[model samples]
Target: MKKFVLVGVVAVCVIIAALIGTRMLTPPPAELDLARSKTSVNGTYLASIEPETEPVSVGPVHNWVLTLASADSTPAAGVTIEVDGGMPDHGHGLPTEPQVSRELGDGRYLVEGVRFNMGGWWELTFQIESDVGSDSVTFNLML
Candidate 1:
């Protein structure tokens, strides 16, 4: 009689404590920061946008990709790509006209020596002129 009542009360208290502990111990999700990335390739550069890490930690311009192909947008092979925007005229003290290679398949291209030395927003000019046509795009980078 009295023992049963005591046991039930203890069980109820334990269950309530477990529920309260669960609520107090749960962790919140991590916040995110991001910057948009742009990519271009070949002799034709279009201002394409890419989602990037939010609140990007200031770092060197390690790897910037060039787009060679898309389901609806594709550039031909063997097309040359030139990017100019470091500082004197529009760069951070790098070459005004830098070159890269184009892979055989789509979505494949390269921009050699693409680096950002200091921390600041930088402009990028992508120029592509081939026997096919001429195209260019302008973008900005934050380091």
Candidate 2:
């Protein structure tokens, strides 16, 4: 009976440990803003992103339309934008190197080569440089 009790206690301890580990790897904060449109960090520009294809899924390449406007709501033309992103919780970058493949005029750019290997909390950051100034915006996505 004593041996059985000892084994049961050890099993309970292992289960507790596993539960704690899972909690530690929980998803991002509940209030993480998954907004598609937001102002740059320094208020230099307003940016928005929309996937060219709806219902983006894992293991597939996709495109996104990125639009930029001035703080006063004017189209930010001829701006240089650098695209980057990663899964914050997983500490891994995008599976593909996405870039501004084309300029669609009227402050819209075609960003291609965006891919998500696994679904989680991902952050897409845009480093934008315009005639006015330079700033960045990060958009959060949950998949």
- Global lDDT scores for all candidate models: 0.51, 0.92
Cα lDDT tens digits for candidate 1, 1-143: 99999999999999999887765444322331222333344424333423223443344333355654322365555556677775322223553244564343554455554555555555556675555566766665554
lDDT of 1: 0.51
What TM-score against the true fold does each predicted structure earn?
0.48, 0.83
lDDT of 2: 0.92
- Backbone clash count, each prediction separately: 13, 0
| lDDT, residue 18, candidate 2 | 89
Q: Report residue 130 deviation for candidate 1 (angstroms).
A: 2.5
Candidate achieving the largest TM-score: 2
- Work out candidate 2's RMSD over C-alphas: 4.5
